[model samples]
Target chain A: MTQQPAKKLYIHDVCVRDGFQMESVFVPTDAKVDLINRLSLTGLAKIEVTSFSSPKAIPALADAESVLVNLNRVPTVEYTALIPNARGCERALKCELDEHNVVMSASETHNRANLRMTRDQSLAQFAEIVRLTNGTVAVNASLSTAFGCPFDGQICDDDLLANIDRIAEIGIKRLTLCDTTGMANPAQVRRICELVLTRFPELTVTAHFHNTRGMGLANCIAALEGGITRFDASLAGLGGCPFAPGASGNACTEDMVHMFNAMGYDTGIDVANLIPLANEIPSLVGHDVPGQVMKAGSYDRIYPMPDWLGGKEQTRLAGSGNALIDPECRVTEVAK
Target chain B: MTQQPAKKLYIHDVCVRDGFQMESVFVPTDAKVDLINRLSLTGLAKIEVTSFSSPKAIPALADAESVLVNLNRVPTVEYTALIPNARGCERALKCELDEHNVVMSASETHNRANLRMTRDQSLAQFAEIVRLTNGTVAVNASLSTAFGCPFDGQICDDDLLANIDRIAEIGIKRLTLCDTTGMANPAQVRRICELVLTRFPELTVTAHFHNTRGMGLANCIAALEGGITRFDASLAGLGGCPFAPGASGNACTEDMVHMFNAMGYDTGIDVANLIPLANEIPSLVGHDVPGQVMKAGSYDRIYPMPDWLGGKEQTRLAGSGNALIDPECRVTEVAK
Candidate 1:
């Protein structure tokens, strides 16, 4: 067997922010703080609490300030906000944010549609935001649609590299290469992550994948193979790309944690603590979420035999000389 | 960038047999033939049409003989059946069957519960069935719960290897290692596949993964890295462990074909042709299947502009501006 490269992994929970952003009900600001606080205690490396976008643009996150100021921060957990512009950065700076996550779409059409700005204009704004946040809050320049776009097709490596170089040069150390519309495959993720690493060897590459095509975890596996250690995931798989109505949620954090943890890689996040919250997301979000781990239960969680199978179950268990049924088998026959 | 090994992939669609067995609703015998005939035309390498078992045991697939005899057999596709014993072998021998797929769970508990026999008993039965089929039909000895079992925690590699060795010695050329419970991770998959290859170098290894825990595709990816080229998939992700209620179906054939074909590996199955069938499965099975490519459309299928974004969407083409909006974006803009 090939030796698996075990490394320290970082999981950043984006449920309260990125997840709730897609919710139209506008999750109460107190609930957002409660979730973030609970997530912080889960030993996660980071928690993206809320987006510092124009409240007028996204009324769902109009209470970003309220959510952030009330956060019960753990010293080890980094708190971040998806900052859209200088105004968002100014607001984030007031809240003692650890990271200001500025984003621009790699596709021009997506940038204008999503952010109401040109690619060049978005980059310029990010650079200025980086300058403003430097020495105070860390900057995460996220390039949405880094793999492919909804309005445009594939984003060429050259354009992505150029963007990465500009962001890195501006002293922003973190970069989130996002499959904004879940357009990335394993090979594509591996190739793009490799290209990005080769260009900016010092850049921290965080994978932000969507499960739109049911490849969120698969893509994460490929990125891990490509040597990426950080990933942006949503608890309970709560978030979908606001743009793609039919697309699924971000890679479910509990699912990813389960895979990495079961494979003996250390993410340092407690999966046991994340389960209740993950299961609660469907109710909170007013719909079914795309998480599989919760539905399937943890890998080691043995299921009891269904009541319908009791008669057949008895014949098998009592019959097999080598049988050792699960202690909690649901279909155990009563003594005759 | 590290090079991806582009190998020829064998996709065996198990929708008619394994998929239908889980459904309480008995899909009519004609519908079974129709689905199998449609699947045969999809350029799939293999189509496991039905299981040759006691009709009383599984009422759903009692018409295995009629289905096999009536197949509009594709010259390129191999048709197989799940043969449990000499009786099954006798039934399959009557038809022009390509192969007899005999299965035994690696987990003793699961083997006993599912097959009403000990592991050794099942193995002995497979050997006898092999003797019965002789040179006429190929035998694919499938070891279910080879990765992890619902009743048992983990199947030890040594016991598994021994079971595999004995089966191989019995002249079964094709072996399928099944994650019957969908409890496998990528690393675990890679580890086991590597072990299997290292031991029995000449055996044709096939991965039988379920999307139970949502890691089906991820496990497939890892198996590919471990030098496996054959996979057992079901159309529209139809098939679940009858024993495990909440677990999802097998990895969808179209999804796997899409992933492999997109990565430049040759599965030779056309994804476009599989889509309509994938969509048809939910209604056929009387419930929702976990297939995603069907729901979200293909990975590259671009969505059109929503009404409010039209002026900007028009400007996107009508003007040089990059502008778009998420169809569900809550910030549609309040009237001034």
Candidate 2:
């Protein structure tokens, strides 16, 4: 039997920042701190702690500074924060974040709606943010709407490449092509990532996807096949854009970790341990969470067989069962 | 750019039988009729309406005969039912089902527990069912646990092939290799489907997968790449073994239809229409369902921009409009 070559994939968890921001309820600062500390112990390469945004804009993440300051960061886990502008960058720098993420949408309509700026202006702002930080933090410029945009039907590959080239010129070494509205197909994912990797070999391109269209994992696989080794996932599939109608949750961290680990790839995250943290979200927020893995549990957690069945082979089980039963015999009585 | 030739893949919706049977609430016979009727209009080539099991065993699908009799079958739709034994075959024959499905788990433990028989006994029962049905219904035998089994890990390919060969000798025209517990990896799925399709060119091999490990879609893609086209998906990711511990849901019907349609492969299913039906299941079952697309809705649903916000070129003019402000200076907020 031939085995596929093993690959190392970096998992950047965004459950606290991206995941919590989308929820209606504001998670308490202490809870956020606890959640971040819990996630740090799970062997994640990076944990996106919070966003440095105005309190009035995203009230849910208003306690970003307190949350960041309170987090018990693991030595090996890199803690990052989302910085939308120079002001946000300054706020993030105050927290001494190891990395800061600045995003620009590829689609002009989404750019205008999401960031209230054109693509070029967003790029310029990102460049300014990078300069203001003075290399204090590693800046990851995320190209949102790289696949297809919710506002616009389809995004052109050339437009996406042009943006990547511009970001690369701004001295951003790390980049992420985000499917903000989850409109990306695997073919589109492969094409976009391949083009970027081929053009900017030195740069590391990460993929951030939503399960809105149910192709999140497929797109991840396509990106992996196209030479991308970094990805952003929300714990238990948390996070959704309030502005993007019909947008589902982000790719579940547990699900992604499960896929990578099963496929002979190392994600450096313990999927089983992540479940409890994932399940805590719905209670933290006042609504039902979108994640499936937390509710369903991992594949290894088995239900106990009936005790009444005893030593005799259990028969007439609905699906797959363990006990042996005689094929020819008919058992009329139900086990009490 | 060269386009890959579109593969012709088939989808067999098993929601009525496999899906509803696992549910705690008994879906009314009229509702089952309505659900199957809606699915038939959605371009499904095949639909498994019910299973010919004893009413005492599976009370949820006890109305199998009534459900089949009431279905508004469209032309080209192959309505099938699961026949567990010779008695079930007789019941299926009486229902006048277009096709009768005989299932046997490849793992001895699963086979014994699920069917109350050993491997050989199950095969003998399948043979008897096949002989007794005598073309009244097309016989399609499903080999469960073809991948890894929970009880017995890592089922060998030769074991599955031997079963396939035995079923072939009994003149079963169609065979489905089921990942009963969702234990299949892509390479394993490809290898088994490739072997089955190559060795039994006359038999129509279909792949049934569970999303227990999140590799359901990947495994399906691998099977398609390996030349096995037919697949089984449950609407809204329904169906799990109540007896099998840790088993969750089947591969979502809406998710699968969305992928196939996006990939330009025709499964003869309308994802747009099917999505609504998928969404309806949660309410019918009185719980939040596992499938994401149904809850999130499709990617095309448009979100209305705030009236307070100016057009795409509008510059922010209010308190904390800064968050919505684009990084690009293409649009500037004018004092209003």
Candidate 3:
């Protein structure tokens, strides 16, 4: 076997902000705070505690401010919140967030459709948010539909690069290429990630993917292969686009961590610690979550021998015996 | 974007055999034959229609002979079946199958636990089956637990290579490395596939993966990158190890095709044609299958704008407008 890579992978949880925002039922402030606190103990590199979205705009996350204020902050884990505009940034600043995550779309049509503003206006708003922060907190711009736009289909590479250039020029040192509607194939993910990294070596690039078409984990793997170490995922695979019909959730946090840890990367978080917390998400959201590791356990989980095999010892003994009546022989008997 | 590769990928559907065997409800023989016939028109390279095991052993597929006789076989597609031993090989030969797929496990504990035979016994059985067929039909040997054995944990490379050497020595030209319990991680998959190809250049290495832990599509990509083109997938992602509790089905066929086609590889199978067929599986199996593309639609599926956004035309008009009274203003109003 090849030696396991020694690189450390950073996992950022956005279950509360990005995930909860799409839920039809309101996730209570206590539940949100409790979930964040539980996740804090799981050794994640970062947690997007909640969003600073307007209550009227995203009523599901209306408890964002309350969740932030009530959550017990972890010193080692950077706590961040989504800042949609100047007002959201101002609210986030008071809550002492370590990072302000601003959003826009690479596609002009998607930018208008999602944020109700032109791409230029969203960029201007981002610049104002950076100016408002005044270096008090780090700002990360999440370029939604950077991989592909649901409205415009595939976004042109030149347009994507140019948008990143504008975001970087506004003093943002971090950028997240969001597969907003899960249109990214692995080849596209690897190619764009490679170009972005080569073009902006100083910026920290993170991949945010949705498992809408079952390509979420695969896309994340491709991004990693293309040299991205930071990823944005949701606990219990809890996020999806409100406008995208029949879509599943985000790249599941526990599932992603489990795969990485198994592949010999140091994710710093044990997936065993995350599964229990993930299991509770169904009760919190009042629906089943799309996480597999929580349901199947980790790959290391050993299942007991089937009862029809008459236990392992019997099977082991019968395996070498020529006896025709043993459980080993039963397969032939049943077949006949 | 990279130029799409011209390499042809062979997708083998095992839903009727591997998938149906795991179902609690025995899909009627007519249903099995109908599903296989529908899948045949989708440009798949091969279909494992059913297994020739003793009917009593797998009651769900007790009508294997009936299914083969009743279904209208496609001219271009290769029809194959699982042949457990001499009896199965005889049954498969009488049906005039294009290929006979035999099986064993690389790990001894798993071999005994699953097939009620030691590794040696399983290999001997494979040799006997090959002798019984006498080169009349193609013989492919599927190595279950080749990636990792749930009972024994990771199988040693030396042991795995030795088993493959024996199978190849026994005149098995086509071999499938199966992650029977979904324990194979991507790094391990890539490494093993590379080693197998380099060592056994004569054998046609196919990857058989399960999405038990949500790494199905990712592992398939890794295997592809490792230079294996043939894949074993199930429609609607049906089929899981009956002994592995909470295990998910096989790598989803449509989803796999969707990813490969999107990545510029020619999978031959059109995902759009397969989706409608995949939609029928849940009703037939009496449970929701773990297929994402069938549920979420393909990545190209464009969702209509939310009703609150007025419509695409209105959004396009409001996108450049400075007017605050348009639907664009609703986000701010609602937030307030």
How many clashes (backbone N, Cα, C below 3 Å) per candidate?
6, 12, 3
Q: What is residue A285's positional error in candidate 1, in angstroms?
A: 1.4
Candidate 2 segments exceeding 4 Å error: A1-5, A243-247, A300-336, B1-5, B243-248, B301-336
Worst 10 residues of 2 chain B by lDDT: B327-336
User: What global local distance difference test value does model 3 have?
Assistant: 0.84
RMSD of each: 7.9, 8.2, 8.3
Which sequence of candidate numbers ranks them by lDDT, best first?
Answer: 3, 1, 2
Whichever of 1 and 3 has more DockQ, that candidate is 3
The reply for model 3, stretches above 4 Å from the true place, is A1-5, A306-336, B1-5, B243-247, B305-336
How big is the positional error of residue A227 in model 1, measured in Å on the Cα after superposition? 1.8
Better of 1 and 3 by lDDT: 3
**Which should have the higher TM-score, number 2 or number 3?**
3
Local accuracy of candidate 2 as per-residue lDDT tens digits, A1-336: 754456678999998888888767888899989989999999899999888888888888999889987878788999988888888987778898889999888877788887877888888888898798788789998888787665454666567778888998999999989988786666667766888899889898899998776677777877887788899999877887654444457887888887676565877776778878877877887666556556545443333233433323433333432232222321111100
TM-score of chain B of each: 0.89, 0.88, 0.90
Per-residue alpha-carbon lDDT of candidate 2 for residues B77-123, written as tens digits (9 for 90 to 100): 89999998889988778787788899999877678767777889988
TM-score of 3: 0.91
Write the residue-wise lDDT of candidate 3 on A230-285 in tens digits: 99999989998754556578999999998888777788998989999999999988
